[model samples]
Target: MGITLVLMLIFIDSVSTFSISALTDSRNSTTEKEGKNADIIRSLLNQETIIRMALQQNVHILRKDLVTIQEKLTDVETKMSRNQVECTSAMSKLESRLLILIDENAALTNAIRSDLENCNENQLMSSMEIQQINQTLAGFDLKQDVAFTVGIAEFNKTWNSGTLVYNKIISNIGNGYNANTGVFTAPFGGTYVFYIAAVEYEKQDLGLDIVLNNKSKVRLIGNNQAAYQTGTNMVVLSLGKGDEVWVKRSYGKGFHSHGVPLTTFTGFLIKHV
Candidate 1:
């Protein structure tokens, strides 16, 4: 409001000054001549008056625009403040969830250890231990056996041999090994560490392609680089029994095998349980 008053006062002052200048010019031209030059001067004075009026009007509009701009700036600042508060709140909630997950994982690990001590030593897994596994294998029968097209052994049994124990296995794959297929079925409910080895460790490192049952996929190694000898790139996926594991190789590429010449390799599931 105070700024509007100042702008109005400046406009009034400019109009008064222009009026005085026009009066002076008219008196001077009348005293000199009432002829062609005088008419030209009159026309010039009129143009100058029109220009001054337009400038004054533009100045008034500019002041109004400035006020509107200030209001918009205030609104933007308010929204920014609210978004900052929301982001802070979300971060705090996520941090709380992380702490809870860590605690739950620790408790579950302790419970598993206690049960393992009381179980039979030679038995791979007690019937009670497989209850959770059955839950994972829901809608599928554990008593049934699945046939293999690629691998020699029923991997489910190998993977679920023991609750706490996992083994590293070497299998025959491709022309070197008897089994040659893109698909491998999981025998048990545990995670399996699938590794591929190089024949001479000098072959091109055209990484392996691992496809999961749920259509999720990951590349073992990348293109153009040789496979890292003895380096294991794996995923800890929560897969149920009877789930399929596959290795698809591009560029006629295959993974390394153990000292035994299997194109693809298999082993124990590496995990906490």
Candidate 2:
């Protein structure tokens, strides 16, 4: 009986040791599976963090580009606005200049008409006088009367806000004109007829007067608000021997005479006194 009891105790001790060994192996397998799962989860978290950082960087670059584009657009708009204002101002000035030109053209047309009428009257009167003289002097020897005349088509000179002189001569008869001094010195006292035509450059107001012996006789004005303008004047005067006649400009204004025949002065002795 003592031998049987000792064998049973040894068998119980062997079974307890087997059971503890199995439990320890199962615990070790569970710990290894948990570690592998934790490693996989950490890798996935790292990939997610990298993707988030890349996305944030792209968004920041996009924002900066948008700001730059906005600034460029603003600059372009400002330049366009300035150009528009300048264009509008230029158009306004052009319109004003056109209007002034129209008015000046109208004035010139009227003056031309008046001058034509006067010329026609003078021609008719001359024709009538010639006819009368022919009829009165039929079959009679007639002596020609002494006559003097001078004319200039262009001045080709410059004058500054004072007396003007015509230096160009077209026709001089009876040796009565001095082109160097711009004077018509009457050889004898007579009834004299004088006429003047003038043109000026753009944007200039030309105020001129026909001066007889240093006295203003008739005034002529050529307005230069247009591209160019013309003016004319006519006068009849009774003068003594050696009388002087010339042209003078108004005060505080300049006059320009192009090389062309844009200005003229003419005088003739109609009859001796």
Candidate 3:
């Protein structure tokens, strides 16, 4: 019985040792699985962190681009506003200048119109005066020849050499003498007697001539002397209708008209041709 008890005790000791070895092997396997899981989780966390950083950098760049675009828009708006103001000012100035030009053009037009009116009035007056002269000339009776006498009224005046003396009208009968032109137009074909008289100042020469159709008919001359002198000339002329006659200085010498009717030209119809 002692041998059997010793053998049972040895068998119990071997069974305990086998159980302990099995438990230790199970714990080692559990620890290895946990370490592998932890390593996988850490790698997932690192990938998440890299993704977040990339997203943050993109957002920052986008914000900077937005600010730049906004500033450019503001600058463009400012330039547009300034251009608008300048354009408005220029337009206003141009309008004002146009208005002034319009006013000036109106004034010039008015002045031209006024000048034309005055010119027309002057022309009308000249026409009326000519008409009156024609009427006066037409009033003469052409049935018979008549006589007329005319003289220069300019006294103590120096007449230039070679110039006709024609300034005033003393008398015009039979509508023969034209004061403006210093000419006598024959009223009818007739034999006429013409006479001319002239007086000069002291120490001055005087000359007178009767001209018919630009032909010298008669001449009277007075030389310069110590005293004033008078000259007279007479001529008989046969004139036709529309014949012209006048008195002129024959020589290029100065003459002075006395302060009287001393310078006289007379013509009378003797008989009709």
Candidate 4:
């Protein structure tokens, strides 16, 4: 019986040791699993922190860019407002100056118009005075400076006793003498002096008369057979306008020498009435 008890005790001891060992192994496995769980949790926490920091940095950069854009917009608005105010002020000043210039121009135009009116009145008064002066001088011989002198251009072989012609003209201030018809028509009522000269050189006697409206006024005679002889005469006449006067050959065949224009007729108005 004691031997049986000893054997049973040994078996009990062996069963106890095996149960303790199983308990120790279970504890160690539980501890290892806990440690692995702790390491996985730490890794997840680090990743979350890195993502949050990156989001914060990006948000800060966006805010700074927004501030810069807002500042630029404000500055542009301020400049535009100032420029608008300046332009309005300049336009107002320009309009005021333009109004002043227009007023001044109108005043100058009025002054010029008034001066022209005064000048026209003075001109009218001067013209009336001139007319009165001209009328007063009309009756008193206004010194009519009328004159003419003519000569024969060529010497003819003989001249018939009708009218003598002076073909060459030295001066004809009044245009009263006609070279083609050899006549002088009085241009105005005047007192005139006349001179006539004649030369005879072809052994002939030459007689010339100053005729007034077909009436004889004076005579000039030259007679020479051996040398040239000249006869001259002068007369003063009071002639009416339209009276005709000329020189004529007196009643015979005559030879008159001319070429230095020696045979000449001259007349002048001494007084005009």
Candidate 5:
């Protein structure tokens, strides 16, 4: 403002001096000369006044422009600073949130691991319980704690003594089905192979059919039935525990009394190979 004022003052002095010189020259000058000087001075003064007014207006406009520029600069700087602070705060908040999530994830992982360990423990316990149950089932089949096998004794349908000791006999088999004299109960659970032999009234055309309970196995003698009177007829079978082995003789519809005893062909429990 002070520099603009000094410039304005200098411009006004030059215009004043030119106007004074024109007035002095006009008094001793021709009409054209006076008019020319007067016009020149008037034009000069008008230009100077217009220039001064333009400068003053320009100065005021420039000052206001500068003030506006400074205010805008301050606003921009303030906004930039605020943005930087906001960015920093947002970054800090994001990092804290991420750390918290990581910690939570770790805790969840540990919880899952603990649950897995508990499941494994339960599995082990269940396995032990199953083992105990199987042991109990295995013990159920044993009727006696000890095993005692006596020697074999000869069985005769008529009468017998010695180790045979009168057990039971049924010789009056006529028609229909013939039941065995001995009934051995199952003592344990295992495979048992039985052997039986029958002596019939010798009908060369009769067939001897043998069947086992539990469908353990079946043996039929149709081949030797044709040679019944020739020699002893034998049948072999394999059975399971609690299986009843029975034999029936069919002699072409005759008064048959299978003379060949059920014990003639003997089969005892043999060890599994």
Candidate 6:
């Protein structure tokens, strides 16, 4: 019994030691698994921290670019406002200059119109004056015509030195000559021409004188011994209105004979002053 007790004690000791060893191995394995799980969780926490830091940096860059863009927009708006103001000022000045030019042009046009009116008035007055002068000249031309031609029908007689009378009238324009007195009266102040002609009876002397205002101006004589002697005289004299011209016998008594009424006198006005 003692020996069997001793064997049983040995067996109990060996079993107890084996059980303790197994329990220790099991505990060590559990601790190793727990350590590996803790390492994996730490790596995941490190990656999450790095990603958060990158996101913060990108947000900061974006905010700076937005501020720069806002500043550029504000500067452009200010420049545009200043340009608008300058343009408005230039337009106002140009409009004022145009108004001034229009006023000047209107004033100049008025002045030119006045000058033209005055010129037309002056031309009208000149035309009226010219018409008056022409009318006066026409009147003078109508009044100044004076002409006369006279002759004697019978002249076979002798007479003393006296005025010769021409009895027959051929032409008497303006009635300037008297057929009974053989005298011509001037109708206007002008130059006058007179002609006297006489034919003496066969071989007889004839003396005739043209008298202007009772003054002898020319003489016609036929005293030579020639058959049918003839004499003629012409005189030009300046005569006033109412001046007289006549033919007269100067020295020889009249043996003046002409069957065809050859004794003649004529007077006419040449020009008027």
Each model's lDDT comes to 0.50, 0.71, 0.73, 0.80, 0.47, 0.77
Q: Report the C-alpha lDDT of model 1 over 40-104, residue by residue, as the tens digit.
A: 99999999999999999999999999999999999999999999999999999999999999999
**For model 3, how does the per-residue alpha-carbon lDDT over 1-273 read when each residue is reduced to its tens digit?**
999999999889888888899888899889999999999989989998998998899899999999999999999999999999999999999999999999999998987776566546545754664576446446544454567777666555466444355555565668788777778889989877787766666557777778999899889875654334556677778999899998887753554564456577777776777
Candidate 5's displacement at residue 213, Å, is 44
Instruction: For candidate 5, give the lDDT.
Output: 0.47
> Best by lDDT, which number?
4
Residues 157-183, candidate 5, lDDT per residue (tens digit)? Answer: 332111121122332121111223333
Q: What would the TM-scores of all predictions be?
A: 0.32, 0.45, 0.44, 0.46, 0.36, 0.46
Q: Could you give the C-alpha RMSD of every candidate to the true structure, in order shown?
A: 29.5, 10.6, 17.8, 24.9, 28.3, 29.7
lDDT of 6 at 143: 49
Clashes of each: 12, 0, 0, 0, 1, 0
Segments in model 4 whose C-alpha atoms lie over 4 Å from true places: 1-144
Candidate 2: worst-modelled 10 consecutive residues by lDDT: 142-151
Instruction: Provide the lDDT at 134 for model 2.
Output: 52
lDDT of 4 by residue, 44-129 (tens): 88998998898899899999999999999999899999999999999999999999999999988886676566446545654664
Model 2: lDDT to the true structure: 0.71
Model 3 spans with C-alpha error above 4 angstroms: 1-144, 166-168, 256-259
Best-first order by lDDT: 4, 6, 3, 2, 1, 5
Q: Candidate 5 regions off by >4 Å?
A: 1-34, 37-41, 141-273
- Residue 136 in candidate 3 has what lDDT? 46
Better by TM-score, candidate 3 or 2? 2
